[model samples]
Target: MLIFFKERLALLSVPKTGSTAYFKSLRDRADIVVSGPPDLKHAPVRRFDRFFQNIFLKMYDTELEVMAVVREPLDWLGSWYRYRSRPELLGHEKATHDLSFDAFVQGYLRTPRPAFADVGSQSEFFRTRSNGRGATHVFRYDNQQAILDFLQDRLDTEINLTRENVSPKRPMDIAPQTERRFRKIHAAEFDLYDRAR
Candidate 1:
């Protein structure tokens, strides 16, 4: 997460949504950059509200408007699948080296997902709290220009981003039937991505 106190903005790092590049580009300008300890780095809306929000409210006397980026559902899963397939994860319990894309996605749809397909849901990540605290701005992963424009205008500085933590390129075709099931099971994810600008 990257916080700009002056701008009253907190950019939530939604996993696999090109947040690493944004972090790299904006770290110096951000007042608080949480880029370590994966759990903290990827803190979802509920987590942030429960842990960090009150601290900022009490100490900084500021209510930061959160921002997040969400990728298309299938693409997001594909990124996770490809990422886990990396050679470095070959021996890991979460490795996807032995699974096909279809199998991986199917596993993801399971009630108790197998380790290799346990990537968290984007919709869940940005879910609004009961008090209505959630991301005020949401961007689509495919729309880098919109993200850049918003950041530049909001931050009052030109922004340049270098790609970082990109997953390996691979053909990610899911079986049509399996995809139908996935879509049904993960409708919220698609809805969230569609709603994003």
Candidate 2:
């Protein structure tokens, strides 16, 4: 997460949405840059609302507007599948090295997902709390220009983001039935991505 206190903006990191590159580009510009301890680095909307938002509001007499990038649900899952299939994760319980993309996605739809397919829902990660609080500016992971334009204007600086954490290339084809089920169970993810900038 990157916080620009003067701008009253908070950039929440939504996993697999190319946040790392943004962090790298904006770290020097941001007043507070969190890039350690995955949990904190990717702190969800609820956690931000509970832990940081209220405090910032109290101190500054205003709350920061949160920004985040959400990717298409299936593409997001495919990224996870490919990420875990890397050689280093071979034989690990949570690795997807031995599973096809279809099988991985099918397992992800389970109530208690198998360890290998336990990637969390992006929509859930960005969900608004009961107080109706959530990211104010959302950008689609596929639309880098929108995010870049918004940041450049808001921060008054040119941003040249470098690609970081690219998953290994692989053919990831989801079965028709599995894709249907994924869309059914995770429709909110699609809805959120569609609403992004």
91, model 1: CA deviation in Å? 2.0
**What would the per-residue lDDT of candidate 2 be over residues 1-197, giving only the tens digit for each residue?**
99999999999998899999999999999998888799899999999888889988788788899999989899999999999988899899998877888888888988899999898889889877899589999889888899999999999999998989989887888778888888887789889888887
- The alpha-carbon lDDT assigned to residue 27 of candidate 2 equals 97
Model 2 scores a TM of 0.97
Ten contiguous residues minimizing lDDT sum, candidate 1: 163-172
Q: How close is candidate 1 to the true structure, as a TM-score?
A: 0.96
Specify the poorest-scoring 10-residue window by lDDT in model 2: 169-178
Screening candidate 2 with a backbone cut-off below 3 angstroms (N, C-alpha, C), the clashing residue pairs are none
Off by over 4 Å in 2: none
